[model samples]
Target chain A: MLQTEQEFIRILRSRLEGTLPEEELNDIVSDYAEHFRIGKADGRSEEELFCSLGSPDDVAREIRATHLVKKAEDVKSCKNIFHAMLATLGLGLFNLVFVLIPFILLVVLLLVVFLFGIVFAIAGPAAFIYSVLQILGIPAFAIWQSPVAGVFFSIGITTFGLLLVIGDYYLARFFYRIGIRYLKWNISVITGTEDEA
Target chain B: MNIQFKKGVLEICVLSVLARKDCYGYELVGEISKRIDISEGTIYPLLHRLKDVGYVTTYLQESAGGPSRKYYRLTEAGRKEEHEQKEEWMRFAASVNALLEGKNDAAD
Candidate 1:
């Protein structure tokens, strides 16, 4: 035989996946085994059998020429994926920060506006109702003042809060969708040229 | 019909025969020689290819008169490939046949 089990195994491990046809490897092993057995009919040594079979490397070159392709594609794809991931990460973070900065600023501004609405609902309205009661000679209702205006003010504040909540929810969802698409596009880009992907 | 063109397909034929049952390298060479004229050396490369592709495996059994003989058996994969190769050749030959038969009626 031109090869031992270990030598043959080395050649097998070296094969690039999807390059060699599966049927060819089977014959190589059987032929060498037969050759080794038949050559031994005359009481030849194992070493002598190996010598006549020629170098494993010589046989390998012919097989590899048909079965092996260049490594350049894998190397190039790996590099492209790495750079794409880094670029996507950077851009995602930038977009996230961009969304967050304005959101935070809007929240702060809304908070300030709500504090004033609360003051009007509690102190400002209370004083206004009291002064109006004094001018009308007697207190109008059993409750002493109408809370109608404050009721309207609270509804406006709640609606404004709801719009902000909804806008934030949709904005976050949009960013998540974009990130998913970015990941998918990059994955396809990396795997697009592969035979077995 | 070109030797170079037949090279790849010849190995397919050799393996297809062996896949049906165990065969010796010399026996395989003889069988191929009957189908097409080729040197003994050419058969080795084909056997090497079949083993490399995992379509066959070997065992050593001693005969009564001489040394141990290496017997080659077709693995399941080899049998399957033989069937597939047969189908492929059938399709190829049939297509060519249809085309040639359409344009001429040599039998008539």
Candidate 2:
């Protein structure tokens, strides 16, 4: 294959066409076109310029990862964030430990907290109902030494559960925001290479 | 001299250079690669990312005997980012250097 200006731009365009928006595609293409044009004018050969530019495919991967990560940040959806993580994972195998492990752990942590919150919230209400029934002489199951104490305890439990749920939500949001920033930093720092990992 | 190490600093280098003066795409890449050996193609994507975040903006300017060239100028935010990243990097490097030169340093 000939290492020429046109060839470099072609590879870049072909790799990025479907992923990047049309306007973005044109802007990126033009940057490299200008590079080749100016380099040639400066008396550099096509091969020399191409060599210095490294692999267009690698460049496209970085661009795609950057774009997806930005999209995920803007939209704030599961699908978007998942796509962004997948794209970043392509940058290198090291991210399997760095990005993927932490992401999975966080997801699991949030889910367990949410489940516990819901269970406590529902159980608290049910316990309160039993206490009321017992007070009315309906022979309900006893969960506490006194029906009055049970009512108070159940109310406290319900409030605590609700707070846990709400706190978990805010925690998830905070982590999501920080996670997006970390992925952006990861792409910029760890993934500029000719060999795709 | 590792490639990953070079890639990490490229963003700050580009922003620091632009904070001084506007540069065309080729000119900016040339300025950076002159000092740090890196794949020049990656700079364009980095520039686009900076632009997307409103840290930088671009314009076209006519050159002698050539088509108008696209020039990148740093925004006020870009300057702030450059200053912050430069300071953070300097502090990080200093700490790492201090650790490396400590008495337990294994490699000479």
Estimated TM-score for each candidate: 0.38, 0.86
| Candidate 1 Cα misplacement greater than 4 A, ranges | A1-197, B103-108
**Residue A29 accuracy (lDDT) in model 1:** 53
Model 1: interface root-mean-square deviation in Å: 13.2
Report residue A47 deviation for candidate 1 (angstroms).
22
- Residue B30, model 1, lDDT: 54
lDDT tens digits by residue: candidate 1, A1-197: 44453554455435422444456565455565555566566477766545444455434443443232122122334334333333333323342354345435654664565565455445545554554664566554434344455445445555555556555556544544453344433321221111210
Best by lDDT: 2
Worst 10 residues of 1 chain B by lDDT: B37-46
Model 2 residue runs over 4 Å out of place are A192-197, B83-108
DockQ of each: 0.06, 0.57
